[model samples]
Target: MSATVSPDQLPLQRLYHWERTAPNRVAFTQPVGGGQTVDYTWKQVVDQARRMAAHLQAQGIGAGDKVAMLSKNTAHWMMTDYAIWMAGAISVPLYPTLAAGTIRQILEHSEAKLLFVGKLDGWLGMKPGIPEGLPCIHHPLAEADAKKSYPGWDDIVAKTAPLAGEPVRPADDLSTIMYTSGTTGAPKGVMHTFANFMAAVAAGLERIPQNEGSRMLSYLPLSHVVERALVEHGQLQTGMHVYFAESLDTFTTDMQRARPTVFFSVPRLWVKFQQAVNHKMPQKKLDTFLKIPILSGIVKKKILSTLGLDQCIFAAGGAAPMPAELLAWYSKLGLNIAEGYGMTENIGASHITTGDPDSFGTVGRPYAPVQCRIAPDNGEIQVKAPWNMLGYYKQPELSAEMFTDDGWLKTGDKGSTDAQGRLKITGRVKDLFKTSKGKYVAPAPIEDKLVMHNAVEACCVTGANLGQPLALLMINAEATAVVKNGGKAELEASLAEHLKHINETLDPHEQLDCLVITSEAWTVDNDLITPTFKVKRNRIEDMFAKNYDRWVGMRKPVVWHG
Candidate 1:
């Protein structure tokens, strides 16, 4: 008795089924110039995908050929993905935030025969990364990049007829080759098939409730597996109406317009949201207001509505571990931000937190037919699921090493299971560092605790070969501005107190020796964070390795400045 759907019920087939059954139903609502939005029906999606598929076929791109898409999230992005598959080609997605070098590497490594550019913020900078011989197609939204003399996407759609019939692909046929945004090391392309996607979509739908009228806001890069599973595939499965965020500036207004019934976000964005609420209503004052039963309901409703999460039936946080304190705080507002655990290799399928209060800190039990177990030796979590990727594309040796002889995909994450079978991730196996005292320190939990402080925007704990670990902290922009305006001493003292509080709760070995407050913020532009918002631990270590000895030797509880 499993909830998993058969491969025959794949997303592409489901798309066609919905097109036939609900052709007029709104499939996507995309924002255009000005403050306007455009709606596309299921029929429109199929029509566009069909025409695009025909165009690809006309260009001699056939089955097994690789097609790459570099773009931000948009209706066209999803349509292009479908068209690639419909044309019997493998789709390769590149994150819009990637630098030209990484972009070039992925495109070359994947052997992409054709490239589609759409709605990118950095297309001008990334244009040089396109391999010279590869043909390019520019979406209408990519007008800036389109000036380079590539054929327009609209031109293809207008000139080509719709594909006569959907191309047949076996369940095991490769659907997409997704490159991992390497936080620890070099990126590797993870290959997933139509069957893998179907399995993930089926398991995810069973765990998270969704139906025809469900709404989702798609802002996270569709290149990521979580957005693909939850937003794209979720749309196909449930006939959900999707709304795309126009840009970072319009995210709030867009969220309000969508009023999404199911919302998902990474932990960094969730932390910012919490910090914003705290700025408006100080934590102490909010706590006092919540004590009044009548006022509590009003405060909660007002806060949720303003954040445009008032209609959210399910709110999930993933791509990184969420701080337990943040989860508790959201719970007080009657919005439980459940944490889920997965990686690109598994098509983002694994554990998800139950809405129950007791399950707050742990990623809940495995989804149906997905097995999870911790390695007895190093505590790495291993998974066996129908949704797991076939292997790392073009790296047979690396692929072979990803699984045990018995076939569980080695997740490379360190975690443990509770009595209720809930999984609590400690850190990545490669992320654990050893102190001079020979004790191993897992930075994730400690970093989570440090980021709970409102002033601390991002944090990394590293002290390899030192007496104890030290936290490299970045102050929030607002907090830094306050310090610049004569609040320096107060901010330092507050940070010191925060460090002491965090240290007291940690094990002796895990306690941070000092907090090094970094001047420059870590960001994707600077290569300090991945596109998915996970901190690049390797880069941080490289930047501070020389200063680590000096910082730890200072023997102060907090460095105040670095």
Candidate 2:
């Protein structure tokens, strides 16, 4: 609640102040061999960053010049990000797995003159699409020491002198420009300023408090704005120590290593965590045991200790709405993983829960100066925040469309405000559908409901022209096993009975009129799911359009993906 920001300090200046106050305190950690740790102190990070800044500035990089970082979550990645800001360059981040075509386009679009590629995937040739001699730096992930191939990130810093001067950043200077996944079209650069990041930190503090002693893990792509804003920037603000996981495969072991006091994750990861717990203890037995209070405590503690969350204050899920059941399950075990809601335009922390069980479905009230209103047209959420972006990088027309004449950002999301003034987002305005019965249907709530059933892995609820109701589903492997164990005729009969049981609980219109089962998974490789694992409904609907008739007429789940 203290609004005492000094008017003249640049971001680097503020960050340096924290490092000075805690010079010997650990600032970051990364995994090493033999279950050992690789750590960086605050002073070391600041000194190295200054030298890296000197390296970039000596190469003629200056204020507003774009610098792109292409790497995974590692110590070098963070060092390079700080150096970009310390030297007053706008940072552009590229996903390591992205298409070379997309990489080329972003590089050309941002006019990024210097590139840093880390821990290269061997499958993608060393010089696949990159123009030869592009002043590129490469750090193989497996290499323990920075090498001569690309000015081993550390040796270059060790040789250079730290640049020193008064900080010159203004709140309005462009800080970072992150690219969208381009599901709708080619990716456009989304811009943010120093004020955007600072305001986000302020808003986030109001919802979820972090202090100098907070310990966190860094696993998500720093290329993404959410993790960058919450974990990276938050660390700069409070001097919290950050740790990085080895890779996607090592997430479990890495969590055990970090034992983070503060955890943040996307919905996809939240679902996976729940799946992990369920995999260890089957749902039916776990649920039946939870009814007895004393036994439930034993179960909850065992699960929490195993997940390395036995001492966490809060674990948060964001980037997409979470299935409510997941939160309740973890909450029962004394793990409070609250859901947060915000988009890239809002600097990542817009609304979040601060306990109070009744607010489960909502992403909570506004954080700090952020204001929201249910827009008069179709009840889409409208917001105004100091943290809102300057606009899309170089796209004035699209930027103009994003804001109204009066300055509110049209959120493009539909929701309602409860009497308590908390917001509950119902669906995206563009996602609603009209059934043949002349009634409007919101598929999101239905999808959320269907996925809660034990048989479902994930489901897409959509109904167009010919349908009463339709759901495309990927059922759980355990459920599939149950069906296969029974004879064919018996499997069909039992599944039909299950549908009747589920329909009895739904209103006549809400009942699913058709269901299609699929054995195949939707993953990043197939272009069906986002990095955060939300299914692209438009693409899924298009894939199943030819068999719309079968979906509408069926009474039991049908295998469509096979």
* Alpha-carbon RMSD of each model: 1.7, 3.3
Model 2 spans with C-alpha error above 4 angstroms: 1-10, 120-133, 140-151, 166-168, 454-457, 475-502, 505-507, 553-555
Model 1 vs. true fold: TM: 0.97
lDDT of 2 by residue, 102-176 (tens): 778888888897888775443253345555566765543534322444666656776999978645577777888
Give the whole-model CA lDDT for all candidates, comma-separated: 0.89, 0.74
Error of 2 at 395 (Å): 1.0
Task: Give me the candidate number with maximum lDDT.
Answer: 1
* TM-score of every candidate relative to the true structure: 0.97, 0.90
Find the number of clashing residue pairs for candidate 2: 1
